[model samples]
Target: MTRRPTPLKQWRLRAASLALTLPLSLAVAAANKPAQGDYFERIATFPVYHNLAEGEARATETVAEITTASSDGSTLYYTDSPRQRLGLVDIRNPEAPRPAGFLQLEGEPTSVATHRHFILVAVNTSLDYARPDGVLAVFDIRDPRAPKRVASLATGGQPDSVAVSPTGRFAAVAIENERNEDLNKGLLPQFPAGHLNVVDLAGQPADWRIRKVALSGLAKIAGEDPEPEYVSINALDIAAVTLQENNHVVLVDLRRARVLHHFSAGSVDLHGVDIEENDRIQPTASLLGKRREPDAITWVGPLLATANEGDYKDADKVEGGSRGFTLFDPRGKIWHESGASLEQALIRAGHYPESRSENKGIEPEGIASARFGKRQLLFVGSERGNLVAVYDASKPWSPRLEQLLPTGVGPEGLLPIPSRNLLVVSSETDAADDGYRSTLSIYRLGAKRAEYPQIQSDPKQLLPWGALSGMVADRDARKRLYAVPDSYYKASRIFRIDAGRTPALIDGEIELHKGGSSVDYDLEGIAQAGNGDFWLASEGDGKKRPNLLLRTNASGEVLREYALPEAVAAQATSNGFEGVAVTGEGALERVYVAFQREWRNDPAGQVKIGVFNPNNEQWRFFHYPLDQAPDGAWVGLSEITAVDDERFLVLERDNRSGPDAEVKRLYGISIAGVEPQADGTTLPLLRKRLVRDLLPDLAASNGWVPDKVEGVALDTRGELFVVTDNDGVEDASGETRFLRLGRLRP
Candidate 1:
């Protein structure tokens, strides 16, 4: 039985959603070397599973929770709690980092901080949730090949976030005796509240003086449960600790082990926010009393900046940290709040997680700031968004967003190695379905355009668009094109694209409606109508929703609707009406809908392309031959567009991603000398001619090849365009690649 989430579990899922928004496109333009300019690009990626020792099953789970680099930025160290070990990486050659070694410990390593020649790890040894116990394990790493642990000290509770001072004189750990949300509805003020541990690092590792600083009676909410989620120490030895569940930030002097300042992280009224997880992205809700339950904290001079993940509910409602980051001074004076703009930017970049829109909207979890050359950069890791945002934070007060960097699932640890002009990030998500293990991504800032987010909606337009299945060029304007979503989104939308933009911009969108009320359907194919209306194909899955053909005006008002005949409807097996195209004019207009897979009566390797005429109120079918599958891959048609009066452009692709993708191409088929089969007869197979090979385009960016090559459109100048579906960031790395293939000779 599928267990329904309890109230507490529901809240946990809510927080999980905050951290779970998931899924990519790498496009054609990246094939050529980009011109030299200031931008960030992912240089390399090191999967944590590569560090598995001899005889270890490749299936063993591992994760990089917290990461830190050596002082010279040549070596990397990360905590892997699942393996109860510390993994090392040798990045002497920044572009190609190899596994150095691993240090298996007795307990789970939660966080790590590197200072000078030593690495400090906070280890959790708790037998249970209530009776929490931990230890501080110090490793001397003067030699990259041989890392030795010289000291260990008892921590009062379970430790989470750890930080080291610039002078290497002290280190601080946030003893987050984190509460299991499954217990007591995950309420606050439970016994044995957590505290902060300040250790003097000047002495021997084992003999370092450790001080447990109590942080109770400071925050307004759950004063006793002072669970410090994250801590950051600065040059002055002042540490900023975030009491995440309590929605507060506390500053402690590491030298004195005393609280110097404390204040509520405060609340902000959010506008234009998507509040419902209804498989849609609608920025119509407002959060008035949302708490900024900041989870990650970092220091910028004397001020502190936090990534407000908003992990738990503090009030009667289920609203916490309404998404984004905030910069504040030591006294808790708010310097600047990103408000809804942070998430809105993610939406514009085509990286927004629609599945997690209701839960903190791409939860910003980890943050790191460093100065390289003349500029200071701030990196914010969005756990659910699966991407890190880079910004020029030189001003300290106002940061300029530079680009969005893609990472593996659940980006939890961020380490900026400014000395090498490099940044490292760790993702903890381990998927069992595909053997997708944890990953570590390395990005370097150099003279180049940002090598990510091939397509994005206009920031000024703020169009919520993804999973684009079918597309059609504008009748009068080539640069203007319209596309529709698949079943991924609940909102039935028609999006307009401007192919002239760098990444091809989603300039605008129109929501569909029926009888003056808003309505939603699984819109797959869209074609422009003669009288400024649109012809839409809503797909069916055989089991429930039937195939529907709709005629709507530009404003999305339903003008006409048509259902398929029972014979055709009965033949569908979830692969119905994927694309639509039209030929002829006005009364004699012939609408063509492409069925994604082979139908009941069709050949094993052939699929039907149905043609409907409004004049005769009748339908006909034509068979399109499919390419042979390779190994575990299946080839099928995803889009069909009218190239001219007698020819059509069809998009054919395989069901494989990454290196396994063998075919992602376009084919041209003509009906000039052929006759479509009558309503109930054997379908006539149409011959196909190679139009273009899309594999080079998908491989140009050097990223993983995406599986869904869904939409294609042709401009008035005969320029070709293509787009891939991101699956609404659900269990996939949300990257949308929109490519302008340029003018194709027809």
Candidate 2:
């Protein structure tokens, strides 16, 4: 070393140089780096969409319509009739379609069309058959079925059919005439006339460009006389139709801003029309001889087929005769056709079943499960069907119908205890009912069904009782059923069930001071901790509601009731929190509760899951970001059993309005961190790991509005058993399915 700088002076120089180089190096590295890590890739998923129609029953005035579209054969759109909501079905794997989210609509929709990324819905506001209110709702469906309504316009007449341009800039609507009605008598309108409304939607914030256009002048055939009125322009197109009458296909140049051409269907009344691009056409020359099929022959270019409903004058006339569909070629030619009578089509579509009265349909609200011996069964509750259905899942997918039983007024949730072969159903009565009373029906598992001898179906034995919004199987020594009496009443009833016979009530009842809608026991989970004790969570309405967590005895007696901290209580609502789960054991035990705040201040407002420690009796609240709101006011939670001590599973049930309401979802929560300890003293520490959704992929999957998912148990096999309360009555299908989620090894 030259002059050998002193140790302090050398250190100071080195530190200065290091600090100066760090900033430059960091900046350079940040500029050249690519995005890293996989925060979005670790999502957990389950069966949230079930499309098994084999055992479906109609339980409501509305029915589900399954529509599919694809890109590279990937399902793009899935929707239902009544709610007119759209959902994205990830059909990259056709057999196991998964739901992404809901596609919002302006109003009830009659028809839908999807292009690369655009979705078109034809909305009719006039419910009266005599009056027609035509409207077009356009959406950006580039995200598949999760279409965003970008523009809406009112077409003067009622829109009966709709289609979108190949470029997705223009939307075509077929406006049906309003039935002429007498102003004074309020009768059906006679001499109804229909027309065509072509909307230019090329630009952003698309407005109805071509406000109104008459179909009469456009429908005039060259040789045929122009009728005084256009009875109906069911087939309206913007492709090959000439200005003259013979051309039935009418092509409107959206870019040119005028009517392009009109094509005739000979004497046929067109019902459907689809247009395709030249690249999409198949070679007709190869199928038929060149002489029979000329060059530029009719190919399936954006094929649009019209179903002829036939004239209403002849009642006996086969509705099918007029139900034929006219297929339009890309070259603008009427190429192929296929369709039965109108009545036949309706029946085939399940719109008009063979015997409407005889059909026992179910509007499934939610599904849950419980286990008996080695077998795990599912219980399904229907809001509209007013019943519950049981299924045997000794075998997966192929669940056999075990029993169809009746409950009280409107059964919403069903819970089963296989150890005792006991099942419980909870009902939320219609608001119109005087008492505002709900019911819980109790049942026993009986002999196996004769047809499926291996399946164990629950018996018809039922014990019905009145209550409020929630119910749970008491974990106390009494091992009774506890319920909230009513919205105003704070008292709960504890009914003891005889373990020897059919789970019948043997003990009287016990009441609690806490007044609320629902209660959850932490022990109701898949895995049992080393300690014999389990946690219990009870929720009261937030703001005006009270929320509490109680350390209870095995017999359902309250050992200690701790009021939730203000941070957690702040999230409570009138409906209170729906479900709760506890993770960790001994001193590390923590409880997570879900609060259903439907009309919260923000859309991102979450369902609250609060954590508490049994050892310290201390608590803290956390929130999870759910994609959508809970369907009903009541929410249910399972126990906090860990896949590993660091990761636990939490089950939740969505609420429903009634039997006909669409079913909601059951979510699986993964917890991280927090390990079990030899000493049961330090509270459990947990961080949310992942959220998994379970249900079908269809819009109708909402039909399963899970009430209170009460019973969560696991057998030695590591299969998770969940049970829900069916308010009462068997679903229309006369069967319910209790769902079981098998734990996967890490």
Q: Kindly list the per-residue Cα lDDT of model 2 for residues 1-746, writing each as its tens digit.
A: 01111222211111212221111011111111112320011011112122213243323222222233533334444334354555454645432446555555555555455544556666667756556575676677565545567877777766644555545565556565444334423222232455556666655646458544444544433222111111111122232222111224454444443544444443333222111112111111111100010000110112323222122111222111222333443223444432222222221111221121121112233344444544545455544444454544333223344444544445544444344344545454423122122333445444332111011112332221222223333333232333332321223333333222232222333443223333332121211224533344454755544666555443445556777656435544565544455556667766655554432432343444555677776655444444433443434343334444444455544444334223234344454443322112332333343344444421122233334444443333444434443322222211122344454322
Best by lDDT: 1
For model 1, the superposed segments whose C-alpha errors exceed 4 Å read 1-36, 50-61, 89-102, 140-151, 432-437, 529-532, 586-588, 630-633, 678-682, 689-691, 702-704
Q: Model 1, 1-746: lDDT tens per residue?
A: 01111222211111211221111011101122223666777767777878889898866898888998887788899999989999998889867778887999989999998878888889999998889999889889899657888888899889998888887888898998888887778888676789999998876787788898999998889998888999988776778899999999987778778887788998878888888888878877788867889988887644578998887875366773568888886657676788887788888776778777767788999988877666666789888878899877655556678788878778899988877878888989866445245778887778467777877888776677777878888878868989888888876889888877776778888888887787778888888866678999998888899888888999888888888888778777877888888877878798998988887777898998988998876888899999988876678888898888789999998887765689898999999888887646877889998889999888665455678898888878998888888777777667777887888844
The residue pairs that clash in candidate 1, if any, are 22-729, 23-732, 23-733, 23-734, 24-735, 25-735, 37-447
Instruction: Please report how far candidate 2 places residue 180 from its true position, in Å.
Output: 35
Local distance difference test, candidate 1:
0.81
- Which residue runs of candidate 2 sit more than 4 Å off their true CA positions? 1-531, 543-545, 567-571, 598-605, 629-641, 652-693, 697-711, 728-737, 742-746
